[model samples]
Target: MKGLLVLLICMLTATSVFAGKADTVKLRQHLIAITGTSQPRNHQHTAALDEVATYIKKEFEKLQGQVQEQVYTVAGKEYRNIILSMGPADAPRLIVGAHYDVCGDQPGADDNASGVAGLLELARLLHNHRLPFRIDLVAYTLEEPPYFRTEHMGSYVHARSLKEQQAEVKGMISLEMIGNFKDEKGTQRYPLAPMKLFYGSRGNYIAVVQRFGNGSFGRSFLRNYKNNANIPVKSLRAPAFVTGVDFSDHLNYWHFGFDALMITDTSFYRNSNYHQPTDTIYTLDFRRMARVVDAVYTSILNL
Candidate 1:
């Protein structure tokens, strides 16, 4: 009987590890596919954006997700937002979004390929789960400048459509930049000086950035995400006036009074490669990135 109990314990442990594991190999492949296009995946490069969108659509198709294209035009040119929906169609929704467009002519590996890769991986990981509610994994385009805070932004269009349909959106989380990290002291910086005292000076943790009065959905998501996260998870709930608070696609959701937040490595705060040609795949830490995706996956399940 004791021998059988030991065997059961070993089996349980193995299952636990396997269940929690995020496939780093798959993450790397997604990143390479996203960042390796012939031209930079920027607003100016419509064909390159379409290439990335095709890749993302194929990936979602592999999981048999109900994929659709949110097509919109900007200044006579066209763009697309690739959406993959899972779970009951009528159920209230949870949104996880990332922009695929990069700034200027850079690989944008960490700038946003990291986030898009996370979105794709989450779709793969969540495909097998019997989720009780709808989850939308969106790959938005034109999130980069010239469209950043405008109605033309892909996220803005998506949020507006959800509002028009009166879709029950529980909350939204934007994966901005999740691949940058550092162990050295003073490597992290903040918009304000006092923030250093609370958040520390290490860029090794993931952050959840929300506006004040983030609503019930945002609160619950933070609690669940923190509980499930394996790496150090830090969160900041501040007014939008605070720099870096409303800098991503989540801001569009918030504009419609939806509970929203951003999960990031604090872009431009710790990552010197932000918007630079140096923002290549070589600078990313895929293992930790997988952890970020793992935590997000578990958190979504619990939510």
Candidate 2:
């Protein structure tokens, strides 16, 4: 009986690992598709943005999700937010969002393509999972400059619409930039220098960024995410006044009184290629990126 018990434990551990592992090949394929466009996917490049939105919509549909386009116009030009709703329809929502827009003329791989790739992979992982709450995987546009922090942003439109409709949103997580990491000792930097005392100086960890009083949903997510983390996971809880805390689509959700946090690789603090043309698919680490997605998927399931 003792030997049988030990064997069962080992088998369970192996199964858990295998089940939580994100498909690295799928992650790479999604990244390549998003970054391989001939023109940059910026607001000015409406056609490219539309194409990416369509791709995201189709990918979600392939998972047999109830996908829809949240279309809105900005400066008379139309932009879209692709949404994939799953789980119980009437339950409170748990939003997982990523922007598909890039800044300037860069490929925006780490800037956001990584986040979208994670979103796509998460959709695949969540397809058949039975959960109690509704999960909305959204790919937003106009998170880039000239529209960022503006009402014209796709995230803003979605959040506002949810508010108008009085939808019950439990919390939101923005996969901002989940592909960048560095093992070098001095690769990581923080908004406040004193933070080094707690977080150290390596950019090898994924950060769960939250604001003060992020509410019960945010706290519960942090707990579950840390419990399921495979790679290094560090959380930064600060007020919005702290730089980079509210820099993603989650900020729009916050505006609508929803609890939200961002899961990121610390962006410019670690990724020097941020917003540069060099932020291409080549700069991403797909294996580590898949691990990030795995962590998120398992965490949400545990939730």
Candidate 3:
């Protein structure tokens, strides 16, 4: 645990060249606070997830955007998905989201705290940028098991509401686990042999995962990102049923027939600490994490 503390402190020490000094400060503070586990249970003092949403909403509001809360009840308890939007309200929308809940009591730094950090950092960068469509930075809840893949998932509720309203969604971008990275040979693992052959065995790359037959957004975004970002990027467009393909908040959007993709570090494929108590901020690479956020920013700007 002492070693872990040292490593987590290193996360704060990184001078993020990609995110700029000011944005890096916001990312560090938010990531540290978000990963401080309160160990709340679903039916008990469930303020843990609520706290994450509140912090994210406050940060977004600080950047001069209005925050909205979509409240839904599950098992008689209220859960919220916090949102902030920019650009024309009636235009087609681009949803960027990350779930803030861990699998259990662990800190879950890489499992999702890193992703939320990316989400927050992106929100900061997009504060003044304008696009033809609206962009929403959403902080979702209840993404981990025994709630994962269930309709009660915060993302499911949010996605269903969009479908019900018949909102014209351009695409959804879900940040799953975007921090952890490794450069050593054989450091990365894949669900199948062919994927390893296609995407490579190095775990140092961030990937865009899309279901086959989905819209061309993922590929176009990947192409733009490849041109402007300094980090390595790979893309996977496979059967939706493939293991690890439809694993995050993006899955809910896919289910609603909206094009969606996940940006991630491949989760358990490269991080052994996933879902474990050791999955603290120590294991994350925030500099590279910042690059991932910058890559997404560049991609969206070019799109």
| Candidate-wise lDDT, in order | 0.92, 0.91, 0.84
Give per-residue CA lDDT, model 2, range 205-288, as digits (tens). Answer: 999999998899888999998988888999889999899999999999999999999999999989999899899888888889
Q: Kindly provide the TM-score of model 2 when superposed on the true structure, using C-alpha atoms.
A: 0.94
| Model 2 pairs whose backbones collide | none
lDDT of 1 by residue, 20-106 (tens): 668889989999999999999998889999999999999999995699999998889989999999999999999999999999999
**The candidate that achieves the highest lDDT relative to the unseen native structure:** 1
The segments of candidate 3 whose C-alpha lies over 4 angstroms from its true place after superposition are: 1-22, 40-45
Give the C-alpha lDDT of model 2.
0.91
Tell me the spans in candidate 2 whose CA falls farther than 4 Å from its real position: 1-20
Candidate structures ordered by TM-score, highest first: 1, 2, 3
Q: Is candidate 1 or candidate 3 better by TM-score?
A: 1
lDDT of 3 by residue, 1-303 (tens): 999999877776654433343255666787788976476323244787777778888888888566899998888989888999888889998899998888867888887888888888888878876688889889888888888999989899999999999999988999999989999989999998777877888999998889888887777777888896778988888898889999999999988999899999999888999888898777878788888888888788888
Please identify model 1 stretches exceeding 4 Å from their true place: 1-20
Superposition error at 104 for model 3 (Å): 1.3
